[model samples]
Target: MPVIVLEARDFSSPIFLVRTLEVISGCITFSLVASLEPPKDPSDLHPTFRIFCMFIWCFFFTLTLLIHILSIIQFHSLIPISWKNLTVTTAVLGALMGLSASVVFPWMVIDHQGSLQRPVAAAVASCITFLAYSSETCILRTQAQEQRGYMGSNPGLLKILQLWGGCNMIPLVLGVVQSQWSALGTPSGVLSWQLWVSAVLYSVCVLMSLVTLVVILGDFAGRCFLPFDRFLAGFSLIGVFLYMFATVICFTKILQLKEPGNRASAQMTELIIMETVVASITLLAYTVDLAFSIKLLCDRSHA
Candidate 1:
């Protein structure tokens, strides 16, 4: 259903409609999985229960990795750019970025069981996510710069989704780090520094997203989109949407369960959602307008 909900919009409306229907059909799938475990009674449950919850959590996380890989392929298909006949480097980086998380989960959860290996694995994954995204963003900026004088229709939607999708991983990285910042109920978990560091880091991710959106919008407005291009605007807009949506989902889930341990988590969640929702939704509207404009550009070219 998560796959279908997102897949519905990538291309033809009929295809999207089919995906939407499929998503609806899978409501039972989500509910069934969610209902499997008894609700956590925060006061009574041992910390081990959270580990059990995390084990079940891997299935959904795997789906996200799948989505990231799919977005990479789809975005690559949209771009005219390439690497030795391969599509944009962005796609390649995205594939690696997705793998980072996929690998981290099994290594930390199944193989090592929160032993020394877990933190080591997570730190490696964090570095991979960060490097992949930053490298991909640099590639995109280069692509736009190379096409500086050659104006055509804005970059295709695929490129937009790919690039921004890669760029959005920083927030994912932060949230993941925060979630497993330490081995809970232990000295590491009790440490104030870890929570404060994560709070600050995630907060930075949120601010970076806002900056990215603003820059993308300004590019469309000022018509300076050479590297990332105006079409990247839609990608940026979608990135913002996913960022905000994920932020909200995380906050709501944590709060509903009353498990966002530190005061920082609660305060940061509120701050992020409030600002991100307003900015992202507005940019989304602008992106739709730009998409229609792209159609006009295509029509004129055909004419």
Candidate 2:
């Protein structure tokens, strides 16, 4: 049996400080939100936004606490996944999710309701948590370079961005489709093909990015028969084209919609526009990843 040892020095580390802030801020945000009375008119607010924000806070709080405990106990070494990759990945995800929750909870839930104390305070705490997570991500990324972790490399960082973009795109695309399904349907009640295509493309990209990250974390890239660099390069090249097509299709379709005459319509339109912008950014990331992957492959070939 492996003996358990406590790493006392870790408690004083900058990473630990940042993570502690994340946990504290996250706890405050969620508790404030949860303590608020239910909205007087539930329909006046979007419950999904509240639920999403709460989920993000609680999920991150729990996960970060668990990670911290594992670190203190020196239990991470017993796990199969690479600790660096896992921590960096969690930090990156927490930052992105925290940012989304910060923007969304304030705009959709807090603004929809009046400037109540708890909700407003929750939003503030959420923003602070987002900053903490962003700081942690930056710190970890810098350390990753010195540690020579795979995820700290150019391609690895690009993969993380790709994953983030894909995740945002998924929800935005689905929300638009769900809200406008009736308007997007033909006389026969069949939904627009373009809507389906956009959703499918984003989903596929997210799946691929997730699989790539898992492979890296599990240290399985070298054990696979295929050349990982070449595969990444080819996938990125294809992803660039796919995102370009999806972005154009999504933007054109959203443009065809009638101008928003109501709050709900306006919100849906905003989501669609956000999705289009994210797709464009994802396309750019894919292009950059392709370039880096090609360069890496060429260098290996010459060696």
Per-candidate TM equals 0.28, 0.87
* Best by the lDDT measure: 2
How many times do residue backbones clash in model 1? 3
Per-residue C-alpha lDDT of model 2 across residues 1-303, encoded as one tens digit per residue: 676756777678898899999999999999999887666753333665677788889998999998888877778888999888888878888898899889888777876656588888999999999999999988877773746377777787788888888877755765676566434443122236777788788888888898888888898889867888877887798788889889888677566655464333666778777878788888888999999988899899899
Spell out the clash pairs found in candidate 1. 144-226, 144-227, 145-227
lDDT of 1 by residue, 1-303 (tens): 223233435545432333233233223223333333333433322223234323323433343344345543554334333322122332333344334434433433233232444444443443444344444334444555344211211333323333333333334334434443332333343334533443453454455444444454333434444543334444445544554554454444345335545434432344334334433443453456356556656776699
Clashes of each: 3, 0
Misplaced by over 4 Å in model 2 are 1-9, 36-45, 144-148, 181-191, 258-264
Error of 1 at 33 (Å): 22
Relative to the unseen true structure, what is the C-alpha lDDT of residue 260 in candidate 2, on a scale of 0 to 100?
Answer: 67
